[model samples]
Target: MDLRVLEYFLMAAEEGSITHASELLHVSQPTVSRQLIELEKELGKTLFTRTHKNVSLTQEGLLFRETAREILALYQKAMRENTGAETLAGDIYLGMGETGSVVFLMEQIAVFRERHPGVHFHLISENADRICEDIEKGLLDVGFIMRKANPLTFEILEMGLRETWGLLVPEGHPLENATSVTGKQLRREKLILPENSFFQSELLRYLGAGAQERVGATYNLIYNAFPLAKASRELIVCLGYPGERQGGLIFIPFANGKDAYASLIWKKRPVQNPALAAFLEHIGHTVSE
Candidate 1:
């Protein structure tokens, strides 16, 4: 298929309206509409659901959107590599979750940038699963994951810091005054936990069998569950950092020796960009030291 047509398809898909995409692309609405029709015809699938004013991607279209984005990204990366700039000049995308080790990562980033200022870092704050997906799709160069890395798929470097798992509780809760809590103590309370298979598995491993039944709510993003914690007296299980305090919330560490660890992970493939290579080298040196 034509790359230009794919660009039009992606623009329409993103904007959710052909007219809006036309305005952004500085092309006529009819032109974008015609290109989209041609793309759908060439692909032999209906990519979008049409309405009077807006459009939405169909199931097939959603799948194709991911493929199309990867295609465009690969094309851009190829162009940058071909430029052959002497200075390190390319984008480094990193996916991160809520971890205190972010400060350490940023310190290393600062050290790297001091010598190569042309490199730019793009940090995407997301959950572990989403970060893994982005890394697999080649959209992100590095990921900070709380779980152990898959030895088959990833090259791992531990951050040398461990995240102490804890409870984020509101005022007047029974466990609010406690310095640290046990798994049995946590099992007694209604829990609001991170909505990830690996995280849930780890929690269950720590809390023992039948603890899954006590989970009241699961959230993809930790902070999004704050409202639920406030509305009820439920407890949230997450990491506790030094001097870190949230408004109307208190964090108490878990006493049962269940702490989450972070690692800098990347796909086991040939290095592509100079910036990524430098960052990887820096991580290796940092971890070694």
Candidate 2:
């Protein structure tokens, strides 16, 4: 429950040894061990599995690790923002999905940071669903998602960019030279597709009936799926970005594809941080111009 104890728990988890964690924390080994014991008691869960040699996280500890990290990050952010109230400076956390439209967002961030040098940016790359969740949780100040903004929950700014859905085929494959591929043609090949449920549904709709049978694997990020696609005959269904090329792979658009639009979204609440407010205003002016 204590922040210091959380730090000790994380250090022990990372080092796998109470001795090593105490050495790093500038405390005695017994102190680290005692704190961990108290932490486990407070939570009523055994967090670590102990051995004579080292310690490892139990299933509960593994889940708690993520919660601890989020707690620490949020605390640090609050401290920074509150302390820097007199200055237009603090961290602005942003989440984004993989999309070419992020180039426009980065441009705005560059201009904003130039005017407020003390302000910093932290960017997280994730799927739209995860990004939305983070924004809702106050872990992110803004999110660039590949979907329409939910007016009820978020204040939105249209990025005015659309991503083309396409196939990432291995070089020298039969479809490499094709200008565009259709759903019927795709049904003949095993395909690697995005793991996001929203996008998966859209893709399935685009591919028509019985197209799910052709799926070979799913990927959270397209780059990770590239090698899987190259090594085998599997085609990767992903968004095509401008001037982006992968070695040993060819990207061909889907015939009459449904393009995914990009939107900048934040929680529909009062903007308490001046840095975030200024950044949003900058984006509005830039987008309008």
lDDT for each candidate structure: 0.81, 0.82
- Which lDDT tens digits does candidate 2 get at residues 145-220? 8887679999999878888898888877898888888998876788888888888998989887877988889998
TM-score of candidate 2 versus the correct structure, residues matched by position: 0.71
TM-score of each: 0.71, 0.71
State residue 102's C-alpha deviation in candidate 2, in Å.
1.5
Clashes (backbone N, CA, C under 3 Å), per candidate, total 0, 0
Give candidate 1's error at residue 92 in angstroms. 2.2
Q: Give a tens-digit lDDT track for model 1, residues 126-212.
A: 888888877776667789888886789888888778878888889888777787888877657888888778888887788766688
With a 3 Å backbone cut-off (N, CA, C), the pairs that clash in candidate 2 are none
lDDT value for candidate 2? 0.82
As for candidate 1, its clashing pairs are: none
What does candidate 1 score on TM? Answer: 0.71
